[model samples]
Target: AIAEAIFRHLAPRATPLAGRHALVTAGPTHEPIDPVRYLANRSSGRQGYEIAGALAALGARVTLVSGPVDLPAPPGVALRRVETASQMLAACRDALPADIAVCAAAVADWRVAQEATRKIKKAQGAPPPVLALVPNPDILAELSTPGPDRPALVVGFAAETDSVAQHAAAKRARKGCDWIVANDVRPETGIMGGMENEVILITADGAEQWPRMDKRAVATHLAGRIAAFFTAQRSIA
Candidate 1:
């Protein structure tokens, strides 16, 4: 607690991201299986919310495209609420031309191919309904794709149950993202819907394991890193 306070006090008061924009996706997308039924993950969006707040504190104009969550909006941030993966993707595209992009939402991998207009009925001694699923649009991949309007920095999050580092490194390469923040989400870890987190930050340079701490602390650390990156880039230019 004291350390965090000190870090914030020592940080430069100048707005590092004054003219820059940051895009972030948070929470879990709910893929509709039926009119009243949906498939979703256990992501509480604490980490993503903290990260967005951290970025905003540094003077970044932040656009947070969030899925269904019960958290309040961060101060000085533009909140765009969404439900499914498709909506989230559209929201992100509309907020384009960002300087940094963070893919933190635990987007559902597949959604019902055909949604039922009404509630599915339960019959006696009848077979259950079959739901045909289809792959969702890969939002992170799209953001990382090299082209005009690509953010200067692209960061992704990988929640894994096993081999956290290995999977995240491969995901970073496969998704063409600049960095991947990997964390174990096994039930025992209590990170899925908990307040604290332990993560390994993977970059082209390598990976660094962070200690378990409050989500806000991690956000502060990441925000500091981002500020330093922009500062260095400006110096080089």
Candidate 2:
């Protein structure tokens, strides 16, 4: 680590992401069902946090809009903590116009239409109360929309239990994002909430399968690709 730091200090030009702004979303959004209850997922925020750190290492100014997670903020990155999916979307919007945006948060799709003010007491011979649900804002699609506010590159994540690549491809087209990183999160795979991951990166060209590795390694690889993308764009211009 000491040697790497000395090398970085000696060669400042190695930071390819200098002057770039990156916006990343992490963890699981908690949509309220009531004062003490909420809808959420199993995301631990490790992958997203690692990605933020990797980008920051490459010298990008990163803003991580995260949901409920116990992890500390990555060094050299600005952290924005939020709970509900609506708040996550608002935070992402506020952090634009970024050069790159990675939508890695596992936001809840539905939220209780109306949260109960107080907990109901259990009673015998009574039917259970039915809770109405409403769809949350589609953050990936919104950020991918073609506009001045849209980032140069938008990446979304798809966690699927089956047919991961196929679903992710469809999602990329539907969401209008530049890239989609798809992974199998079936309990058997142990990728979700686990230390490692194997992913399929879908882009305009095609899907590329990445070997199983630690989440931090995956983050470093993705950050390198992002830097290469900007470099290619600059060369073309």
Candidate 3:
């Protein structure tokens, strides 16, 4: 089934994404405190990678700005590996003017103020070491805000453990993005770093709920919907 799906996706199609450049960000950014330790999320980059693959299959010039992930790079896509949120933003800036920009990366909200040159060890009579943290740049917010080189469509991911749809809808408005894909990451569900997820698609117009499906299926459906949206826009124009 996997092989057949790959072949079908790679087959040529007349989708609107074809021939247009699409930029996708995936995985969890690691914020280093010491050489051997870092703060990161549970995102495994599965969904982001699948989205890139789906877009590529539709013939889009796909550029994936990925964070640290164990998964292999997607076939037939330009891969830019980044470890920090700042680096990811730089890559996105360089890949601008794309038709679509998907911010799928679970970025670290905060980072250590100063990275330790040497790993701190336990002292004979001391307490645990203290670490100062500062907020990381909001990469999605920066991209979605009106800019000279902003993409036509900006999509963000909101991983919410509670009030999933409401949080995602608010994020869409707060981040100034065209759409937000909201996922529930509660303990029992295990959506984060998991194979399957139930998602709510939130846009300015309204919200749509989709049944739980594998990450690959979600990506395929999103790609097709994007194509249809562009088609409608063209017709209206």
**Highest TM-score model number:** 2
121-207, model 2: which lDDT tens digit per residue? 668989987878999999999999999899999999999999999999999999999999999999999999999999999999999
What are the runs in model 1 whose C-alpha is more than 4 Å off?
1-13
Name the better of 1 and 2 by lDDT: 2
Q: Write the per-residue lDDT of candidate 1 for residues 1-237, one digit (tens) a residue.
A: 476446556774656876889999999999987789998977999899899999988879999999999998898789999999999999999999999999999999899998888898999999998888999999999999999989999999999999999999999999999999999999999888999999999999999999999999999998888888888999999
Using all chains and alpha carbons, the TM-scores for the candidates as numbered come to: 0.94, 0.95, 0.92
Q: Name model 2 segments beyond 4 Å from true.
A: 1-9
Lowest lDDT sum, 10 consecutive residues, model 1, at 1-10
Report per-prediction Cα RMSD to one decimal. Answer: 4.0, 2.0, 3.3
TM-score of 2: 0.95
Clashing residue pairs in all predictions, respectively, total: 0, 0, 0
- Taking the tens digit of each residue's C-alpha lDDT, what string does model 3 give over 53-141? 99887768899999999888788789999999889889998998788899999999899999898987879889888889999999999
Name the lDDT value of residue 126 in candidate 1. Answer: 100
What is the lDDT for 168 in model 1?
98
Model 2: per-residue Cα lDDT at residue 199: 97
Worst 10 residues of 3 by lDDT: 7-16
Best by lDDT: 2
Report how far residue 206 has shifted in candidate 2, in Å.
0.5
Arranged by lDDT with the best first, the candidates are 2, 1, 3
